[model samples]
Target: MSTMQPILRSLPRLPAPNLWQSKFKGSRARGHLRVSVMTEDAADAAVKDMQISDHPQRSIIEIFPGPGQLTRSMVMAGAKKVITVESGETFQESLKALEQNSEGRIQHFAMNPLSDPFDEILLPEHTAIPGLKPQSWDKVHEDVMIVGSIPNSATGERVLHELLTASIQRMGVFRMGRVEMYMFCYKDAVQRLIAAPGMPPRNRVTLLAEAAAEITPLVRPGAAHFHLPYDYQLLRLVPHEKPKIETSVDVMDFCLRSLFTNKSHALNKVIKYERAHAIGSEFLGHPLLGPGAEILLGRLSFDHNIKVKHMTLDQLNEVALKFEQWPLRPTVLYDDMIMYESRRKR
Candidate 1:
């Protein structure tokens, strides 16, 4: 429904860039990289759905915008400023063309988003999210958007995790505000983001994502969507207005890692096999869970035989709250790799 949508649809398709034309000459040869081109209509629809046009002063930090396909749509849709973080030089010509056309409205960063400190290179001075300040965790702002199609790998997942954690912690790429991320990732990555308590493939990421943000499916791949070898989805993640648990992220992180060792096993059954030796060490060092796993388990007030997959979000929050009240804090170093070995044995 945007004015740009019609204009973009009528423009003639340009020839694929040299990197994509040759396909085998550059990063395409690296095998890990993939560039999924979509029609201008598709890009326009995606930008419109994100509501970027609603904000006249919107700023976007896009990751891995190979050759600026979506970037063009964003600029056309009226984003106030656009900054793309891309490392590969293969798309330099096309992106430079976009920059030249924007007349200073668009900028490009020739750096890896995963390794670079965003404040140092990615975000320009005026682009910082309003009302953001150092060491201010509770401060809230809503002017910035992070949009990208991340690579489908552990490294890509790690980068997203780091970005979300930094946002929650009010550091790194998140200094501008609690960012809203719209990411296109493989179906498996999507599963990890939306995984529930007792679902298959549930693990650390499930709790980490749930505790930090509300993940919603924006688009599901279908015949009309962008073509790719594997099905993928666009997910929207916004920080939770009120997190289910009000404990240290580290505490909940340690607790979830310790308890989900045998995720399918009943909570009572797995607790016995967890590294009790590490309970006094630094590994299971959560303030509440570190000292009193049994106590928190009792507070759950559920059948000890319940599998973690079956537990609801409220039940998980109950566990966290119970840990906060424990008077005697203990330290632990439970072997975090218990679940990995369990999966291998299965």
Candidate 2:
């Protein structure tokens, strides 16, 4: 099968890191905001699964969808049909995406959601997918799902209006009333959606992901601990259903002499027996590994003489972002959060 790398390569990368600044202005400071508030759809989906084991009737639509491997896996694992939308001319991206999906819950739609072209992209047949359509929303669980990467170029005003309008559209289409959309989103857009004056309260979505909240021992190639730089955190809209995901393989066990002791041998074994889905690259939009994130957060830490108390989860999270201001990969924020707590125990 084709891989995640090839697919992601087809999409446009975000502009130079300078533009990514000002991501957390709104939600970062808003403590009253809810974890569920930012991610009601995801939470509702979980609730749906709890209430209805067979989400048999839902259909999904994701816009400007990217390497949809995970959601596809989840849907194929059990979700009904998923309708994915894309604007660029990537051929058969959706069909290829469906192959990797676990339950075949995804389909692709190539249309410009910004224009009238969007209306033409809808399938007459999709109106019937279980929890995905609007007519049957009340009777269904969170049967419909919508997710994708938000174009970084979108303006604050445009994003705010689009988020509200799109949420309504997705809700109108699927049985999963108020379908949720998870995005590799801009922080500014999130703030605008929630804090923009004259915005609706119930419709105010939450900040599901960002560079806050800490966790530790969350690094990869574990020994690179000190080499790691920057503040990072495992910020998310929803707590992971699977709290820990391990991608490690033991070095040597049964029969190791000379040829068998190679690390390459272990990697090969990892590739063989472990889930093939896990073998692909794990993407994290970290500030450290990416541009400007490390320097931004790191400088802020020293500038403030930042200090953590009692290794509280919140404090650990604080430090993780500070690490981002330094020089490290963003995903390492997860590790730093844990390490912050480990030091606190002392």
In model 2, which runs have C-alpha deviations exceeding 4 angstroms? 1-56, 90-105, 116-121, 125-133, 136-142, 155-160, 166-177, 196-346
Q: What is candidate 1's lDDT per residue for 266-285, written digit by digit as tens? A: 66545444443233322322
Q: After superposition, how far is residue 50 of candidate 2 from its true place, in Å?
A: 12
Model 1 lDDT, residue 229, Cα = 38
User: Which candidate tops TM-score?
Assistant: 1
Q: lDDT (0-100) at residue 148 of candidate 2?
A: 44
| Model 1: worst 10 consecutive residues (lDDT sum) | 1-10
| Distance from true location, Cα of 292 in model 1, Å | 7.7
| Candidate 2 to native Cα RMSD, angstroms | 23.1
Candidate 2 residue lDDT tens string, 1-346: 2111111112222222232223211122222111111122332343243222354444445554433433343353344455655444432453454544423334555555455333444546544243223434333224454444344343323432444433333323322344434443344444433332223221212111111111121111111110111121111122222212121101010111111112122222321232211233332222212344334333333322221111222332343344333444333323543443354358
